[model samples]
Target: MLDIQSLRRDLAGVAERLASRGFMLDKAEFSRLEIERKLLQTHTQTLQAQRNSSSKQIGAAKARGEDVSAIMAEIAGLGDALTAAETALQALQTELDALLMGIPNLPHESVAVGLSEDDNREISRVGLPRVFDFPVRDHVDLGEKFGLDFETASKIAGARFSLLRGDLARLHRALAQFMLDTHIVNHAYTEVYVPYLVNAESMRGTGQLPKFEDDLFHVPRKDMEKLYLIPTAEVPLTNIVREQIVPREQLPLKFVAHTPCFRSEAGAYGRDTRGMIRQHQFDKVELVQLVEPKDSYATLEALTAHAEAILQALQLPYRKMALCTRDLGFSAAKTYDLEVWLPAQNTYREISSCSNFEAFQTRRMLARFRGENGKPELLHSVNGSGLAVGRTLVAILENHQQADGSVVIPEVLRPYMGGLSALRPATD
Candidate 1:
């Protein structure tokens, strides 16, 4: 939500900025509505004043034992007129607010204005893709050697699902635990356990509702209201402080949570339908930061680096891309996607996304902080996947495959795997 004063003062400039994100702001309608709002507001105030003065006159007439019927009739008519004006003012204000709610966040000046992901600029690269001497096998092939059974998973669930067995399943669990431990212990983030199911307001606070409703999985129980399977811990964790005014000392609140994310994949019927790359459910350790407005931009960069730390520690090759205006989401002023290299695909794939929502979400949630003068002001919100556990597992299997169809565990994950050095094929 933008400051209404900013919208009123710089309507033209604000409209143009929103246009870059494909939002059609009706300035003409907004201007007309603004005019109506002012006129109705003034009329209501004037009528209220008239009613107050008339009430005083009626009281004096009653005390003097004079004829009060004429004055009483005038008061009754003024009450009706005042009530109508107040109703009209409320309607106009509601219309104006609806228009504003549909508008996208204004892009930061540093964000490049472009139409699609092709326009995104690459910022940095880490590690290097490993060279294999033999015909390389993808994760699906390597994983099957150690009991990754898609057939069994499909039987239990449906498509876009997999069942890991033996050491493979343990590796998957270890990966999530390791990621959570790293984010909490080393990254200076408070470990949080958030609800995997959230209410509609939580979704709306993070700008996931009203526009992306079809992309979510909603579960409605008979006795309780509908709840959405959280697409990411970011939604639940960040909304914890929604509509709150935190003390200035807690300006930079860093939180990390691990949760199973569910996405409907409604429009993506046939894309990445292979393996675990695009699953109905996946584990991700999300990082969320609510900080002072002035510190958000720098915090975004630092948060991205923290995500890169996990990939670096695992020795994964990856690159960062700066999302252009068209590539940015409705809530993000700017975004960066970190794509990790998968040896099987022979290319990089998105494993994490980081974004700074520069007061866009804070305003909607009424999330604020006390300033030096003890006045409330909107805080900035940012969140990202430190790393998606499923994709990370895929990258490790494909990149660290051994000649004998075994998987060499990354040194960082060795402890988590109970000192296991390699994942060997079980003689079932």
Candidate 2:
């Protein structure tokens, strides 16, 4: 949430910045609402003052042993008017809050102004796509011999789902474990275990609700608040500091979690339906950090490197991209997407997205840290997928596949695979 004062000070300036990202500020409506709010607030205050004065007059009349009924009646009428005015003011404030909540975070100045992903600026590329001596196959074709079964998965859970058997399943698990271990051991992140189902407030704190509700999977209750299946570990990890005020000593709090993510994929019907590229459920190792506001931009670069460490360790060829204004996530002021090379697809696809929210989320969450003045200040939030386990697995299958359809395990993942050098077809 932006500081309301900023909007009041320069509505046009804020609107122009927002326009770069394709959001149109309703200036006229906001102005009308603001005018109404001021009038209602003044009227309410006036009535309150009148009632107080009338009560004092009634008290004086009683003390003098004289008639006080007129003053008493005036106080009663003022109380009724105050109640109505206060309610109107409250309703108008709620409307304004809703409008602000729906607005996306303002992009950082460094973010390029563009309309789509194609306009995103490339930062750097690492490693090189391996040369295949034989005809290459996509993950779907190459994974079948190793027990990648989608038909059974469909019978069990419908389309956009997958089931892996034998070593193929282990590879997926190994990827997640490898990512978790890497971030915990080398990246200075505290590991956490969190619930997969969260309340609506948690979703809203992370900028997922009240706007992108359709993209989430939720569970309705009989008489209680509905819970949502987290779309990423980022949701749980980042919300740890919700409504908290940490000491200055703990300037940076880093957290990591490996969890299964659920998404509805609403409005995305026929895209990437051929395989596990896009699924209803997938595993991920997420990284989150809370830091002092002044250090957030620097932390963003370091955090991006932390995620890049995983891809580099696995020897995956990937490129870092700075998302343009229009392509930025709803909560992120700035974002960097790591796209891993997929040999089968003959292209690079997003495997991780590192972002710095710059107090955008903390404002909504009331997440704060104590400053030198002993006052609370909003903390900046940063989070990214150390790596999406499913996409990493897909990249490995397509990048490391041998002519015989076997996959050579990346050296870093060997220990998790019980020292196995490669995955072979199941003999069954």
Candidate 1 stretches greater than 4 Å from native: 45-71
Off by over 4 Å in 2: 49-71
Model 2 weakest lDDT span, ten residues long: 71-80
On TM-score, the leading prediction is: 2
Give lDDT tens digits, candidate 1, residues 91-170.
88898877777677888999998988889999998888888888899999899888888899999999988788888888
- Candidate 1 residue-wise lDDT at 327: 84
- For each candidate in turn, give its C-alpha RMSD to the true structure in angstroms: 2.4, 2.0
Candidate 2, 285-383: lDDT as tens digits: 999999999999999999999999999999899999999999998888999999999998899999999999998899999999999899999999998
| Candidate 2 structure lDDT | 0.92
Could you tell me every candidate's TM-score relative to the true structure? 0.92, 0.95
